[model samples]
Target chain A: MASVTFDHVVKRYTSDLTVVKDFNVEVADKEFMVLVGPSGCGKSTALRMLAGLESISEGQIRIGDRVINNIAAKDRDIAMVFQSYALYPHMSVYDNMAFPLQMQHMKKAEIDKRVKSASSSLGLGNFLDRKPRALSGGQRQRVALGRAIVRNPQVFLLDEPLSNLDAKLRAQTRIELQKLHRDLGTTFIYVTHDQVEAMTMGDRIAIMNAGILQQVGTPGDIYDHPANIFVAGFVGTPTMNFVAATVQDGVATASGFHVKLPKALPAAKGILGFRPEAVTDRIPDPDSAMEMKVDVVERLGSDQFLYGKVGGDSVTARVDPRIKVEPGDSIKLGLDTRTLHFFDSETELALL
Target chain B: MSVVSPATKPGSPATKPVNLERRSLLSAIRPSRAILNIVLVVSAVFWLVPTIGLAIISLRPESLFQQSGWWTALTAPSQLTLSNYQTLFAQGLVARGVLDSLITSLEITVPATLLVTIISSLTAYSLVFGRWPGRSVVFLVIVGLLVVPIQVALIPVVQEYRVFGDLSGFNPFGTIPGVVIFHVAFGLPFGIFLMYNFYSGIPKEMLEAGRIDGAGEWQLFRRVALPLGLPAAASLMIFQFIWVWNDLLVALIFLGNNKHATLTIFLFEQTRTLAANYWIISTGAMISIFIPLIVFFSFQRYFVRGVLAGAVK
Candidate 1:
């Protein structure tokens, strides 16, 4: 197992079309570093460049102590599981897993031992003789994983490997992948557009937007303190609500409410950000609470969500499922002031 | 109809009994299906008539073949014998020519088909997956070559062969290898065109997966792209095999009617000089048809519908 480092990496397709700019990350040994972003955000491009599948336009990537920019993909000694579980359809599962070993010209007995152990670990022991077409989607995904695991390379790269599975399978595979990572203790560079996967899986998540690195932190760190407005909005479910507000003296004012800041800020205009959970149905202090005119209520059995308007701006709130609420009902909700965030309107960078 | 109509409604107590009776009635006399089957059989028989006629003519005695049409022997079954086949085989020189022609055809067709399939597959793999510069331009040139007629290149290629002989001390003008080379040249454009389109359909992720699995370029082509391209390769072999096998023009021009004549050239020579050598012509045609028929039928299984199913989600 080895740590991976991308130092000042840039992926410029053409003079005017640079996709990833000055990408830099230092993944520690045995770290599960996830690169997450929306489509066209160049997260996958960064992973591809590190994989050596794509040529880096500038800078250097090193695995352990070896610089890899001039190396071929096969020579890089990294295995990648594609978003498409690209199992060799003509070969049986055994051969699929044994392919890398065969390429290494390893002894036959050792290859068999590795393939058998990997297949069994993947719960694919019975499927060793079956072709890829005979396996289900989840099984095919496991075979892809098995193929990588058999190689036992210094690092494992997975590009949205669980995206092809059904929802239930995706959930199950996500946990299994985490367990596999723990078992292997290999440095893994995983890329995905799904924030939930990032939050649940990564030892550290690096969020990117428009080819620029937004933030790199532990999931809890990122969730509690996103560096910019984009990370704040993109990292959360139901997303963080951003309300345009103006600060005067120590008070911040918006359309339907005003709150006193803990400390005074020089910025006259800023955006207030808060998670849905921070807006609760019970108001701890009526004076600080704002009235939300509920437009739609979704009861998800365990947790209910209220989508509504607060002073002509849309807001979503996570509320108690037992509480009886309906659309067009006006309700009072409290903001957890300590959990609230503020970003400058001009820079969109976090102010607190 | 009346009974079935009442059962069409939901929760009707009469549904099951009427459904079973209607199904049995429909099965007993399905007129539309019957008409479709009859039409299919008629078309199949219409396709087979010429082949069956050739078979019968090949079986008829040479005297009877000249005296009457094959239909006459079909009615009088006793007159239809294997005598024509026997006579053609019994003539020592004719037998030698047939044997030599068969060998020559095999020598030309097998290499040509194998070379075209292998070269086209490799070229298509590179075109689709290789990261080299000018790949698109090279592919476009190959596709452009598809439109240049083989007839146009015939004279120029023969002159070029003579020039090559002058420079290299080896002329390809009237040899088996000469015919094989010509066939491979003319066959490659379409072969690459077909295989390139097919290879393009294979998910790019598949090749990427191979690369990450530590496969080099040659390994990727051999282990991933080639296996996935089997259906296209199989069909290409069948096409190139039949085209070179039955080619009279290329063989006649490049491999002149000396000793190294292909089956088609030999058959053509029989009909060209001895116009009345119907027995030899019919028998030789059947022999030539026999090889390609075996080839097509043997490799027909590779024309499988979903070879790439479940390759990717």
Candidate 2:
């Protein structure tokens, strides 16, 4: 078992540009750690640095007790599933899976046993003799996974491993990956830009933005309590609604709606943040009901989303699908004040 | 091998979309295509007639070879005999010397082809994947070297070989090794150019994947880069082999009057003699043609693409 530590890791390309700025994260042993962010956000760079495919410009990264800064990629005792899969074309599926084991100078019987077991586990037993070119995309991806798992390395680094898969396969693989983490009991450092993968797969998610670590917390912690405006806006679908508001005496008021805050932070002007699901059709708190000028209404069987204007700020509300609402309707929706997050307008940091 | 089903198939293209390609062979032969086929066949026949004539002449007796055209033997089959070849065999110096030249040609060509191929592939691999500084600059320098013709390097290289011999006491002149060295040197830049361009198209991720699999740099080259580079390397080998096999200038300038006279020099010597030995020239020409033909045919099967089709998304 190995836990990876990145101490003040900085990836600077030049004097003027730095990709990962003083990043620090300690993944516990056997923990499923995900680095999630937008494109060009240096999440992949951080993972690459950990995988020894990239060099750390400053500071150090340690796996278990060893500082792996100078270690060659082959000696890092780690396996990675790339976005492109990168299967060896000349090798058969069986050979591809056994390549690393053979590279270790393993005995033929041991190599065969591991390769057969890994390929069978990956459901690639039937296609073991086929070259990579003859297989489908999903099959080739499984061969890549089979190759990585066959070695049973100390750590697994998956860089958007499911990105090349279709949507249905990605969802299926996400569950299998979590199960894999459980079975292997190895530290998994997964990097992806897809928030749903982060939320559904990672045991602990480290959200990064613009080369800086934004927040490190469990899915529930990140979902319920975002660290700042960026995390709030990035983590959820239909996005969180942000309203420029004035906070005074524990009361936050926007253009048309006003809500009472639980506790007041030391800020006069702040941004009010709330997820789409927080606004409901049922009026739980009639006192906090606000008027919404609905511009578009979407019914998705399970939920209904209303995209509209609550005064000058546009907001989206997820309500009971049974509730009938349409465009150009002026509706009264209840905002759960308990779920509200107040961010300091100047700093964009969450206040409550 | 193709999706074009026979007309008898249940799911033939006739059921839908009016496919023209699946029509009967007779109908498929359009006027334009027929004309194209005829033109191609005629051109091919025209191109091969000289080699056919040489083969016939090589089989004929010297008396028949001098008296009649080679085409006359096509109708008079009895006139063709192996006596000329027998006479060639009987003449020990001429026949043994020709065979020796053939052996010498192989020695020069094989090593030149092999050395150029291996060194060029290694150099190209370094230029493409080695993380050192000035890689593109180095590649550009090699590309610049490609424009330099062997004619320009002939005198300087000969002088350099002398200097090398004077310093080392193993002067390259009067030996086939000297000719091989020249061919390998001139073949390298083009060989590297072809290989570098080819290796550039391979996905860099495959090599990175190799590294992650605990493969050392040499293993990555041997296992990944080398296998994927076969087609380019094969063609480079064939080109180098044929070019060296047919070369006269470098052999004459470097390996002059040596025991290992190459086939090209042997043919040149045939013409230099006062009698102008047509028999040796034609017979030797046939041997020279056959060597490259066999080489080309043997290597052509490896020029396959799509080996990397599913290696990545």
Candidate 3:
């Protein structure tokens, strides 16, 4: 297994149309790096370029110490599992797994041994003799993974591999994939559009938006510290709440509420950011709290979410499940002071 | 098993005669199927009437031709004789001409079918998978050639073949190879067009997966693209085979030499004689029909749609 590196990579279809711009990342040996973004964010294009499935329009991608810009995909020593499983439908599971090794002219006994071990590891022992058409969706996905594992490539690239599975199966396979990476200890470059998959699966997550890299950090780092307003709004579930506010001399004030900034303001006016769970339902008091008229209450068994308006700004607050409230009810919610973020009005960079 | 009486069970909450009545109602559609079967059988018989008459005419003695229509002989089973077969065999009609035509037809059909299947698949693979400059334009050109008549190319092709023969010392015209070559060329445009359109529908991810599996272009075509393309290939083969098999003009013009006549030419020869040998022509026709039927039935399984069924979730 080898580390992969992309140096100032750029993909432009024409003069005006660029899909990946000045992208750079170094995936250390055995590191599971995930590229996450919304649709048309060029994550798949970046992965494809590394796989040699796409041509590099400007920069170089290196595996180990050698540049692979001109290399053929078959010579790149990387295996990709597709969102659509892309299994060979006519071949049995055993043949599908053995195909890459067989193409390399590996010995029959060795191909058989590797295929059997990979299938058994994936819990597909009983399905080796069946054609892909005979398998279910989850089983087909496992076969796709087994095919990749049997090759024992230098890097494993997965392009939204678990997106086809149902919610429960995706969760199960997510853990299984993490365990597989641990077992193999190979460099993995995974591309996905689901932020949760990226957050849960990667050692480091690279978030991209509109052909630009927004932030690159650990899951917790990205969660706790986003670099900009987009990363703040995009990274969290129920998304971070953004309020139009004015900051003056380390104190930030908004409509019907006020909070002290952790540091001096970089701008007199900007947006304030906080997570839903960072706010709590409370009784209105003179010293603290933002008064909101609750428009809807969503009780998700273990937690409750209040969707409402704080003055003119729409906001969502995560409160205790036991605290019952109704629509059209005016309530006071207190924000956690330690978790607040301030951004410049023009630049939108995190100021606090 | 419960031992309750029917009267007591009737008014019970669990008891309902509705399900049993509905079961009977569901089964009531069997008569419609039977009626449909009868109609199918009648239609099949209607279609087979001419073929049955041909078989009857082929079996009747030559002396009975002027006496009445061959259908009259069908009423008298004893009137049917194997004299047509014996006479045809005695004259070397079955022995030499039939053998020659069989070889010629096979010589034309096998190569044409194989060439069309192989060449079309490769073309389809490129049109669908290969990212090159002007791929769509190339595909449109191939599709456009499908509309050109084979008759339009016959004279020019023969002239070109003569020049090639003069330079290479191998005369393609008036030979079995000439007929096969002509058929292969004319069959290719349609073959490539049909297969290309079908191959375009195969998901691109499958090819990408094959590449990531360390398969080179040749290996990918053989193991992934070709097998997935079997249905279209089989269809192209069937089309090319039947067309070359039924062709009379190309074979007659390109294979006019005495040694290279195909079944169509042989059948034509029978009609051109002073006394047309309907018996020999009909027998030859039946023999020629046998191969295509065998080919069609043998490859019928490949034509099943959804061979790529579970390739994707």
Q: How many clashes (backbone N, Cα, C below 3 Å) per candidate?
A: 0, 0, 0
After the best TM-score superposition of candidate 2, give how far the Cα of residue A334 lies from its true spot, in angstroms: 1.4
Candidate whose TM-score is highest: 1
lDDT (10s digit) by residue, model 2, range B173-216? 76778888888888999999999999998998899989889998
Judging by DockQ, tell me the better candidate of 1 and 3.
1
lDDT of 3 by residue, B126-187 (tens): 88899889999998988898888998999899999989999999988887788888888888
Q: Deviation in angstroms for B271 in model 1?
A: 2.1
Better of 2 and 3 by lDDT: 2
lDDT of 3 by residue, A212-255 (tens): 88899999999999999988888888999999998877778887
Candidate 1 — which residues are off by over 4 angstroms? B1-35, B92-96
Put down candidate 2 lDDT per residue, A1-352, tens digits, no spaces.
7999999999998998999999999999999999999999999999889877888999999999999999999999999999999999989998899899999999999999999998888899899999999998889888988899988998999989999889998889888888888998999999999999999999999999999999999999999999999999999998999999998777788998888887766648879999999988777777678889999998889889999999899999998888778799888899888799988877888878
User: Clashing residue pairs, candidate 2?
Assistant: none
* Superposition TM-score, candidate 1 onto the true structure: 0.94
Higher-scoring candidate on TM-score, 1 or 3: 1
Regions more than 4 Å wrong, model 2: B1-32, B89-96, B274-276
Alpha-carbon local distance difference test for all models: 0.89, 0.89, 0.86
